[model samples]
Target chain A: MTRIAVDAMSGDHGAPVAVEAVMASLRAHPDLEIIVVGDADALNKEIARHRKADVGDRLTVQHAAEVVGMCESPARSLRQKKDSSMRVSINLVQQGSASACVSAGNTGALMATARFVLKTLAGIDRPAIVSPIPSRRGHTLMLDLGANAECTPEQLFQFAVMGAVLAEAVHSVDSPRVGLLNIGAEEMKGNVQIQQAGKLIGDSELNYIGFVEGDDIYIGDVDVVVCDGFVGNVALKTSEGLGKLIAQFLREEFSRNALTRTAALFAMPVLRAFRRRVDPRQYNGATFIGLQGTVIKSHGDADAVAFASAIDVARMEVEQQVPERIRTLLAHSLGE
Target chain B: MTRIAVDAMSGDHGAPVAVEAVMASLRAHPDLEIIVVGDADALNKEIARHRKADVGDRLTVQHAAEVVGMCESPARSLRQKKDSSMRVSINLVQQGSASACVSAGNTGALMATARFVLKTLAGIDRPAIVSPIPSRRGHTLMLDLGANAECTPEQLFQFAVMGAVLAEAVHSVDSPRVGLLNIGAEEMKGNVQIQQAGKLIGDSELNYIGFVEGDDIYIGDVDVVVCDGFVGNVALKTSEGLGKLIAQFLREEFSRNALTRTAALFAMPVLRAFRRRVDPRQYNGATFIGLQGTVIKSHGDADAVAFASAIDVARMEVEQQVPERIRTLLAHSLGE
Candidate 1:
């Protein structure tokens, strides 16, 4: 049975909603065990509201009296707030009581806690955040999405290798093609760091497809696109904002006339399918790879359904042993 | 009267389209004089086809023997192609033969040639590329769109001042608020360089607002957003791609059925207005600020209409003397 720790005190909605999500996910996956880490009284109160009894031996609660504020300094929180729900959830993964940890807390705090508790794998210097970005064709896995703002060429190479390995294991793409994010398709068009990273990636064993532009991200030209966190974050947020703006614009256009509204009724199915394909909640969790244990970061504003989906993602990561696959990939490269 | 130099051989369509655009723009503004920079023979052939003899006085053909290839290295071409159209056009700006220079050739070549020929203002260490970005409300200006990949804190400060100055001169916004682009709106969220730049901007006199996220780029939360070229380029291109994608999606949605087609005919006026407001060609040129003379880089695929619009933009910049205003602003800081 897969056991995962959920930071019940995290996210914009706080403990009650998180507790509701944990209970809902538990009801859906009967074989899965969930250890909710937060204030015991509040979590139990919410759990009792949804669940009649213990339901199974699968449910457990761990008490952490404190909570980390979203705006607090991550380093300070990691050092001082040892009993915070965020910290305790990561501790569960560190002690192997739970196979993975899921949180909707401050991203920096989660990264700091996971790094401090679980520690980086032997060959990885810095971990990266991987988020599946929805495209016209399907979802594309992008890495270093927001974990490391500054990176060396070696770090990017490791990110590409890890991302490729994860895609191979999770998405089942054999020989996944890796592309460097750049301003243009030409080989010599980016900054010094990208140029150096391109050379390193080209020399590596991974299937490197020279360079891909920002437009190629939505076009699904490659399986893995790698960049530093700053650029990656900008791309992710810009794409998200554009998606919402476009949806809003279309809705405004469709409602402009009665005839268009009538036509919208017929086109609703196709439009809904398109909206579902690009829904942010469907791809909410960002995987923090390279740590000894799995940690998935849900969006701060994630609703109960989205948070439950994140828990499901954490369970899948634990069951698939993605960290081990990444470790093995790193080991092979080191041996080479 | 504003006399601008147009690189007839710069864009994809070359001389004929460029000349036609100049002719069209001249018809709108009869007082405008255009120096068509290219081979005299080819330009004469295109102009003769138009059958306008007296138009010669308003439009002068400046002879240049060579042209810079789009894929050519900027540094290499600057050294080798001294008599190229790109170089001659910039030389006109430097010599005051033309008030400003406009080109749709290689961006790097245009920047390099402009910098080499006109030189940066006394206080400016590096030049920046500034473009008007479409926003939900209207439009906002973003700086360092692609000029320099790496920028120091002081360079960022100067960029803010330059960007603000341009916005005031061109967009006519008094005391345009400047914002540093960061992953989060918090003070300490971005990389070390951005944090340092934040400190500098906060202390500067240029209506410095705090940090902004990528979502604010489209929401028009700040008048001027500053970032290094690496991040700025990703943001710009991602927005461009999304704009195109959204337009395509809307067209598909509106033409899905016969009823919607009838609605589209009535809503056509409003939709056209919206499209015109956000059209990429409407904001086609990017100015290379901090140079001694104004130089505008039009899109490589810019048609005759877009190229003519770029000339109008160049004329405005020259008429306003943007470089002089920037010099005045920087002199107090740099004592130039």
Candidate 2:
């Protein structure tokens, strides 16, 4: 049976949401077992709300004494909160009690704790966050979303490899096209490190397309795009802001007069379909790749559906043996 | 009359679009006179298509023998193509024959030629591209869109000053709130240079706010957002990509079936208003601030209405004396 550990108290809505998500996830996947780590009292109380006969041995609770705040310092959380739900959940993976872990916690704290506990894969230097961004054709997998703020050329090359492997395993794309994100498409464009990284990637066995600009991410021609964490983070957040702004503008326009309101009722189904097709919730989980074990991060404010999606991502990575695949791929490509 | 120089051959659409834009701009503002600089044969033919009575001395042609291709090397264009239309237009600004210069050309060539001809203002180290991005409420002025790829902490500070001054002069806001764009809003979040730049901006007298994240740009709280050119360029281009993707998605949804098509008919007026409000063309002009003379960069693919908006931006900047304001603001703040 595949088992996963979840940080039940890390999200904005605490253990109740986690319990609800766990119950739903267990029903969806019969062979899956979930251990929700948090204050035992809170978790049990919420678990009691569900049908006890349905849960059986599939659902359980693990006690944790502390919780990490969303805005807490990563270093402080790692040093002080040894028994926190976020730390305990990752610990379950290290102990081999759980095949993978999912958390809706402070991202910095989670990354730091995961790296310290599970360590990097044999051929990898740093673990990078790889997530899929919805695009026109399908979706593009992008790496180093916010892990290494500043990266060496070699680190960027490493990210490209990990992204390609994950895309192959999860999305089932044969020989995914990997792209280095830059300001322009020209070979001479971008910062010095990016230029050097381009040469390295171009020399690799991975299907390396040349540099891609920011607009190319949504244009959806390339399959995987890699960049330093800072640029990726800004790009991701900027897209989120634009999405919100457009939604706000649409609402204002549709509510301007009674006639427009009538249009909204007629257009509701199409709009709903459009929203579902492009909903960020569908792309909720960000996998911390290159780690020795599987760990997925949900948005800190994720609802039950979004948290369940993160759990599903963790389950799939475990089934596909993503870390083992990454290790083997790196070994073959780099002769490490 | 405020005479402006137009590089009539620079844009993708070339001289015809420039002539059309100039005629419209002149009609909109009677006090404006424009010199269309390009090949005499082509420009005159296009200008002849307009009514001769409307062509009074306000619209005239200045022959420039050569035109710089969009893909031409900026350094090579500066060194070899001295008589290029883009170069000659900036030279007109330098020679005091034109109050401002506007071009929809290769951005690199425009910046290189404008800096070489006009020179940066006293006490300003680098000229930045400042443009307004539509936000939830109104818009935010962001600087260093792609001018300086790698910037020192001092250059970022300089960008904040320039952005604030432009916000005051063009948007007419008193003491604009200038924000340093970082990955996170915390005090110790970004890379070394960004952290150092945050300190410099925080110490300044110009209504300095703390660091703003990428989402803050469209949240419409801050007035001026300063960032390195690489980050700023990625953010701007990413927003553009998202906009196009959403438009494409909306088109697909509306054309899916007969019911959706009928819904689109009912939603047409509201959708049109929504598109108009967030249209990128309305915010086309990016002022090359910190230069000694006014130079506006329009999108290379701009249509007549968009190009006319760029000329209007140049006229407003000339009237408000943006460069002089930035120079004075910097001299007072930096004691340079």
Candidate 3:
């Protein structure tokens, strides 16, 4: 059985969403075991409310006295929230009781706690966030989403390595094509940092495919796109903004009058299919790569379905032994 | 009459597209005079083909012997292509024969040459590229699209001032709300540069609204969004890529089967309205702000209608006297 620890109380919706997601994930993954860490009484009540009392070993609750606020500072959370649910869940992973941990808590707190607890793997300076964004092909893995806002050229090279390993392990692609994200595709296009990183990556054994522009992120010519956390974060959030704007525009046009409303009804099926194809919830979980243990961060506002998808991602990472694979790849490629 | 010089060569489609756009703009605006600069014979042939021989002095052709290649290096273009159509068009603006100039040529070359020829306004470190992006409320003007890869705090502040001035002038808003683009909205969220830039903008006479994340760019909460050219460029190109991906997905869904094809037929009008609402062509032009003279850069692949939209932007900037207003604003705000 693949054992996973769930931080049951840190997200915007709190324990109920986490408990419901746990129930749904348990039902979906027959060989899965989940330990919900939070206020024991509230979690038990939630489990009872869901009528999941019959599950014996597959579902269990571990008491955690506190919860981390969604907006709390990472440093303060690390110092003050030692017994917090987010920390306890990660503790479960460090203690070998769980193969992985999933949290939709404060992102900064999660990264800090995960790094402090598991520590980065040998030769890894800092843990980087790697997440998949929808593209023309299946999807492309983009790294350093918001962790390590500023990075050295060597750090960018490390991110490239980690992203490539995760893409290969999760997607089962051999020698995945990696790309360095920049303002322009030409080598002479970006700033000094990007230009220098390009040289390091070019010298590596990975399947480096030169540089890629912002549009190339979705054009799906490369499987793993790498950049500093600052650029990646802005790019990701900008995409979110654009998606919302397009949806709002479509809503306005479809509701302009009775005739357009009728057209919307006729187009309902096609619209639904299109929405399903680009649904952000399906791509909810982002991994904290370079850490010694597997940690997946879900969207803080995730509902049961979205949280369940995150659990699915944690399960896959656990089965693939993502951290171990990354360590091995780093050693082999970087001769660490 | 506002006489504008149009670079009749240098775009992906070259003279034909520029000539057609000139004809369209002449028909749209009677008070507008356009000098098409390129190989005289080719431009004349295009004008004759459009049956616009009787445009009189409203539309004229200026002979230029050279055209800058779209992919040519900016430095090479500046050093070698002195008599290129792009340079000649800008020369017309500098010589007081044209109120402004528009080109769908190489962006780097355009910025380099325009800066070299027109020079930055007093108290401005670098010129920024500002363009309108669709937002919930009409649109938001964003700056530093790709002009300077790295920007100092002062440069960012200048971009904010310029963007605010353009928003007020072009959009007819008073004291437009300005924002510094950052990874997080919090004061302490971004890198050192952004953190310092926030302080600079907050202290300025302009209406600074604190830091905004990428989503706010399209949320329309702020009138002007400012960032370094690299980040801004990535955000803009990423939006373009996402737009294309969403359109491709929609097309696939609508062509899935006979039932969906019939649905698309029924929904054609609504779909067209939505497409038109978010169409990039309507927002085709980006201004080179902070320069002494007004210059507009259109997309290289722009069609006749899109090019005409760029011409409309040029006309608006000419009427608004954007560069002169920026100069006055900077003088007052920065005490230069």
Error of 2 at A224 (Å): 1.1
Candidate 2 global CA lDDT score: 0.90
Candidate 2's residue-wise lDDT over B239-273, tens digit each? 99999999999999999999999999999999999
Give lDDT tens digits, candidate 1, residues B15-40. 98788888887777777898989999
TM-score of each: 0.92, 0.98, 0.98
Query: Which regions in candidate 1 have their CA more than 4 angstroms from the true location?
Result: A27-30, A51-55, A185-191, A247-271, B48-56, B185-190, B247-274, B334-336
- Tens-place lDDT digits, model 1, residues A1-336: 999999999879988778878888888887789899999999888877875464476888999999988877888898999999999999999998999989999888888888889999878998899988765556678988877778899899899989998888877888888999887512234468888998888887789998777877776778999998888988888777666666666677667778667756655665665565456787878899999999999899999888988898888888788999888877776565
Clashes of each: 0, 0, 0
Candidate scoring better on DockQ of 1 and 2: 2
Pick by lDDT: 2 or 3, better one: 3
Ten contiguous residues with the weakest lDDT in model 1 chain B = B182-191
Output the number of the lDDT-best candidate. 3
lDDT of 2 by residue, A164-235 (tens): 999999999999999998885122344789999998888888899988889999998999999998889889
TM-score (chain A only) for the predictions, listed in order: 0.94, 0.97, 0.97
Candidate 3, which segments miss by more than 4 Å at Cα? A51-54, A185-190, B185-190
Worst 10 residues of 3 chain A by lDDT: A182-191
TM-score of each model's chain B: 0.93, 0.97, 0.97
